[model samples]
Target: MTRQTGAGAPGSPRVAGAPARLAARFSARLEKWLEAERTQLPLWLPVGGVAGVAAWFWLPAPAAWQGFLLLAAALALPGLVFGRGGRIGRAVALFALAAAIGCGLIWWKAARADGAALPHAVVAAFTARIDRVEPLPARASVRLTLHPLMVAPDPRGGAIALPGRIRLTVPLEDAVAGLAPGATLAARARLVPPPSAAVPGAYDYAAVAWFAGIGATGKALAPVRLIAPAPAGGPSLWLADARIALTAHILSELPPGEGGVAAALATGDMGAVTQDDNNAFRNSGLAHLLSVSGLHLTAAVGATMVLALRLLALWPRLALRAPLLLIAAGCGGVVGIAYTLLTGAEVPTVRSLVAALVVLAGIALGREAMTLRLVATGALVCVLFWPESVAGPSFQLSFAAILSIVALHELPWTRRMFEKREEGHVRRLLREVAALLLTGLVVEAALAPIAIFHFHRAGLYGAAANIVAIPLTTFVIMPAEALALLFDSVGLGAAFWWVTGRALALLLAIAHHVGSLPGAVTFVPTMSRLAFASIMAGGLWLALWRTRARLFGLLPVAIGLVMTLAAHPADIFVTGDGRHLAVRAPDGQVALLRQRTGDYMRDTLSELSGREGDEAIALDDLPGARCGPDSCAATLVRGDRIWHLLATRSPYRIDRPAMEQACAAADIVASDRRLPGWCRPRWLKADAALLAGTGGLAISLVRPAVVTVAAMQGQHPWALHAAARPAGAIHGSYRRFSQADEARHHSRNRWRD
Candidate 1:
C-alpha cells in the first residue's frame, strides 16, 4: 500500500479535528460551571478557609524570610485581583487571601515556638511561678504550667534564664506546700524535649506542645516548696480559684467517681474521673457529654433562656411590652458567654459559643438561626483565629457532627415532617422520639469516617446509646448542674449538687451498661489518606449542595469504601527508639522481638492490625523465637519464605560472633551495634544510626522473595531536624537486594554455614 501524504493522510483529519473539538467542549463546560458556582460564592467561602488550613499543614514549616514573602505575595495578589478583575477573579483572590492568612498564622506560631528545649534528660533546680494547674484524673500527680524565674545546673551553679513555659508533672506527695496558680515554687526537675510522633501520621505531640507554648515536659525530682503564696483576691486568680472551689464543693457533696463526672460537666475539670470511667464513656458513644461542647452549651443556654422567660412572666408588664423570643435569645447569649468562660474557653468551647452567639444574633435579626450560611460563618471565624485547631480531632469531629445535623434538619422532607402538627400527648412524644433517632443516625453517619480515621474504632451501638443518653443528659443532668451552679452562688449548692450527683450516677450506669454490650465497639484497620479524603469530599458535597447533583457524591464514597476494604497491614513495624520490633507471622498475628519497651508503638501496631487490645505479647509467644539478656531473635514464616529479625541492646562496637550468627540465621538484622564489614555487604540491616534518623520503619513483603521498606519519618516536619539519609537510599537498598536475589535464582542458601 502507498504511504499517506498531505491532507489525505489516513489519520490526519481526525487527529487535527479532535483537539479543536475537545477544546471547544471543555471551554463551554468550564464557562457553564463557573457561572453556576458564582451564585454559590457564600458556600465556597468555608471551602476556601479549609483550603488555607490544608495548604499550611501540607507545606513544610517555612523560614522567616519565606513567610514574609508569602505574606507579601498573598496580600499583593488579592489587592491586584480585586482592583482590576471580575467576579471569578475576586473569588480567586478571596481564596488566596484566606490561604495566605492560614500560612501566616502557622508561621507566626512556629516562630513563637523557638524556645530552647533540653536536648537530653537533666536534673536541675528550678524556681518558677505556676501559671496554671490541672489535675490528672485518678492520679496522684498534677500537671502544672510554670514560668521559669531561674534554672540552676545544681545548687552551686549560676541561674539560667529559660524562655517559654514548662509543663511539670508533680506527684501530690511532692507538693509539700500545696500548688496553685501564681504560687512560686522551687524544686528539682528532670526535663526533656517534647516527644515526637511514635508512628507516621499519628498525633504530633511535639507540634501540639510547640503550639501550646510548652517548651519542655518534666517531672519534679523532689518536693516542691512554696517560695511565695498567690496574691489575695485578684481578678487574675478569680477564675482559677472559683473553678477549684467549685470542684471541691462538688466532690464534697457526692461520692468520688460520680462527683468527678459532675465536676467535669459543670467546670470542665476531668482530673477526678478514673480511667475506667473515661473508657466506659468513650466506648459507649456518650463521650460527647463529658466534654463541654456544642451539645452541653446548647442545653445550658436553652435551659437558661427558659428560666429567664419564666421569671419574666412573673413581671407581666415587661413580657407584654417586649418581644419575648428576642429577649430570651439575649439572655441565652449572656449565659453562654459565662459558661464559655467558666469552662476555660477551650477551642471547642469557644467554637460552640460562637455558634450559639450567631444563633442569638439571628433570632434578634428575625432570621432563622440554623442556616448553613450561619454555620459556615461560625466555622470561618474559628479557622481565622485558631487555624491550628483545624488539624485537631475535636474541631474536625465537632464541626462534622454539627454541620451534618444542621444539613439534615434543613432537608425539605425533614422540615415538612416537623411542620406537621400533632395534638395528643402520645403523638407528640412519638414524634419527639423519632426526631431524636433520626438526628442520632445522621450525626453518627457523618462522623463515622472521621472517628475511624483518627481513633481506629467506631461505636457500633452509638445511635441506640445516644437515644437513651441524650434525653437524660439534656433534661436531667445538664439542667441540674446549671441549677447547682446558680444555687452555689448563694451557699445552697449542696442540695442541688446532691440531686445532680444522683442523675450523673444514673447516666454513668447507662454508659457502663451500653459499653459492656457485645460488639459495642468495632475496630477498624487504618484507612489510606486518599480513601479518607474521598469520603470527606463526598460528605461535604452531600451536605453543602441543595440539588439532585448531590447524589453523585456517593460515587466517591463507594470508591473510598472499596479502597479501604482492599488495604493490608504492613508486614513489619519498628519503633522510633529502636527498642521494639513487630513482624507479621504466617497466621497474621504480630510477633514481638522485644517485650518491655515501646509499648505505645506496639499498641499502635496492634490497633492497625485489627487486634482487640493493645497489650504487648511476650517474645516467647511466637513460634521459633528466642530471647537472651541483651538480645532477641524471631523468625516469621509467610508462605514458603522465612524472614528473620534480630534485636540487640549492646553498645555500637561490632560483636563478630553475634554478627556471624545473625547473618547466618536471618534475612535482616536490627541491632544497636554496628554490623561487621563483611556482613554489611551481605544482609539488609537497620542499625541504631539509621533508626534514629528515620524515626521508625515499616516493611511490606511484596512476594515471598521481594521485600519493600518505608520510613516513618519520610519528609515530615519533625523529621527535618534529624540527620537524613539521601531520599533514594531505601529504594536503592531494595533494588540492590532484588538484583542479588534474581542473580542467585531466589536461592534460600545464599548465606551458608
Candidate 2:
C-alpha cells in the first residue's frame, strides 16, 4: 500500500525525471558547442599564448617561488580538467596547456639572465667590444652595442666585471666614425637605466631593454678610441659587414634620397632615410614596405621559386629527373634564410622567415603551402622562441596583417567572388584590380585600429596610396631589387641596381604626393587601455572565427569606438622630472609653464589634445600669473572657482615676500627641491621625491571645489618595483592647514631674502 501511494502521485515521477532531463540537455548543448569550436583550436592556442605573455608583463617582478607556482598551475590545471571533465573541459584544457607553455617559456628566458643592471647615472671608463653599430641619420651619433670587458671610475683602477650589454650613443667624430662590430674600444661613459614610460600606458622601454640584454643606456663622456681590431669577427659581424657594404654600394650608385630607399629595401637599413621621407611613408601608409617583413619575404621567396622552375624547364634533362617544385621550394627556403640573416634577423624578419620556411616545407612535403594552421604554427614557434616579441608592435601588427589576409581569403563570399570566370580581357583586368583593392582594404582595416592605438594617427589616404604602391613594389621593384642584390654579390649588376633605384624613386614620389594631400593623416587622441584591449579582442574574434558567432565580435568594437570618442584629455599634465607642467586654458589651448624644457612631453600633450601645432603660450601671459627668476605663480579659473598653482625650481630658498604671497595665493606647489617643514603644513606640495615615484600626474577638475587626480604609473609593473611615496603625507598637511596656520604664521613668513 505504501509503494502504491508513492507511485500513484503523478507529479512525483515528473519531478524525479526533471533533473535527469535537464542534465541531458545541458550535456548535449555543451557537446554541440565544443564540436563547433573543435576546428578553431589552433586559433584559441595563440589567444591563450598571448594572454599568458600579457599576464606575465602585467604582474610585478615575481619571486622564484611565485613564478614556479604559476608555471605549475598553468601546466597542471589542463591535465586535471581534461581527465575529470567533458568536451568543454577538453577545449579549456588545450587553451590552458598553451598558456602554460607561454608562461614557462618567458619565465625561463628571464631566469637565464642573472646579471644586474649598471648603477643609474654613473660615469665610468669601460673597455668594451663593439657588437653592433647603428648609424643615426641627421645626427652626429652612432649607437653602439657594447660587450663590456672592463669598467672603472679611473683607467688606472682595477677593472670591474660588467655583465650584459650596454647601448652607448657615441659621437660620430673622427674617433668613433670608423667603428664597426668586433672592434674593441675604450671610452668614459655615463650609464643610466633605460628611460621609464614617457606617459601612462606608453611604451615600456625598461622591459624592452631588459629583454634585449641591454642593462643600461649611455652616452660616451670621452671620445671612443679603437683599442684593438675586433676579436675574430664572428658570423654576426660578417653579416653586419656585408649589410653595410651592400648599403654603401647601393647608396653610391643611386641619388641621395632614392639610394637610401633602395638600400633600405635591399639591406634593411632604413636609418639613411630622411625624417621627411619617413613622415611621407607613414602618412601614405606605405611604411610597412620600408621594413623587411611578410610581404618582402613572400615576394623574394616566390620570385626565387618561379625563376628556379623556369630555369629548370629550360634544361629538360634535369627537369625530367628532378622534382622541380620541391627543388624550387628548397631554393626559396635557402634564399629566405639568407635574406633573414641579411636583415639582422630582427623579430619581424624572423617571423616572416619562419612562416615562409613553413610554407616551403609544406611544398617540399607535397602538401598545400598556405593554410591558417601553418600561420598559427609559425606564430606559436616565434612566441616560444622569443617571448618578448609578444610585447612588441612588430609582432602584433605583422601577425594581425597576415591573419586578416588569410581570414579574408577563406571567407565564403570572397572565395565565391574569386571562383567566378571572366569572359573578356577588360573584365578580367577589372576583376584583378578589384582583387588588389580588396586585399589592400582588408589589411588596412585590420591594421588601422592598432596603428591608432599605438601611434595615435591614421592615414586618411592609405587605401588610395596602397592601390598604386603595392603592385608597383610587388611586381616591379622587389623583383628587380632581388635580382640586383644577387647580381651585385658577384660584382656585375650595375644595370639592375639602376633599374631598382628608378623604381624606388617612383615609389618615394608616390608616397610624397599622397602624403601631401589634404587631410592625409588624422590624429586620434590616446584611448584607455581597456578600450584598446576590447578593440584588439574584437579584431581577433572577427579574424579567427569562421562561423556566424563572429558577428558578436562587433559589439566590443562598437563599444571601443564609443569609449575612444568620449575620452577627454587631462586638464593639467606634469612630467616625472617635476620641471614641466601643461595646463589647458578655458579656450582649450595647452599652455606651458616652462617654454623650452620638455619639448617632447609638451608636443605629446598637444597631440593628445587634438592640437595641430606645437604652439604653447608662456605662463607669464596668463591672467593672475607672476613670474620670478626661479619660480612662477598662476591662478587657474575652472568654472566659478579660482585654483592657484606655484612652480619653483628652488624649493630650499625662501624669499619672505614671495613665499608669503605664494602661500596666500596658491592651492598647489610643485618643485624639484624638498619642501620646508614650516610651509609643508599649509600648502600642497609635489616635490622631487613625490614625482620620482608617481612618474607623472593628470589632474581633473571635477567641479569648482572637488578635484580628482590620476598618476601615470598607477598599478603598472614598473610602479610595483618603484619606491612607494606617501600621498597621505601630502594630504595630511592640508588637513592641519587652518589649525596650524596662526601658530606658525610669523616664523614661516621669515624667508632668507
TM-score of each: 0.87, 0.86
Candidate 2, which segments miss by more than 4 Å at Cα?
Answer: 1-27, 60-86, 154-163, 485-494, 585-588, 597-602, 612-629, 637-642, 649-657, 678-684, 703-753
* Tens-digit lDDT string for candidate 1 (1-753): 966656757678766788899987876675556666564567667766675665556544455435644764676586565645345455566666666666666556656655455454567788999999887647888889999888776555654446578899999878765578899999888887776665454555776776777778889988888999987787658888788777887777789889888888888989998877987998888888889899888998898788888988888889889888888888999989888887777888999999889988987899986888888888888877887788777988888998998888888999887555847888878887898889998888887888878777788778888998888889988777777877878888777777888888888898899888988887676687678878987888788877676788999988887887787666666655666666665555766665665545666766665654454466668776766666666655554445565666545453577567556556666765455555552345666555545555666554522221224323434342544554335444343335554444345443321
Worst 10 residues of 1 by lDDT: 704-713
Candidate 1, position 666, lDDT: 62
| Local accuracy of candidate 2 as per-residue lDDT tens digits, 173-252 | 73554578889889988887766654454455766776777777888888888888765557887889888888777778
Candidate 1: deviation at residue 53, Å? 1.4
How many clashes in candidate 1?
Answer: 1
- TM-score between candidate 2 and the true structure: 0.86
Q: Give the Cα error of residue 489 in candidate 1, in Å.
A: 5.5
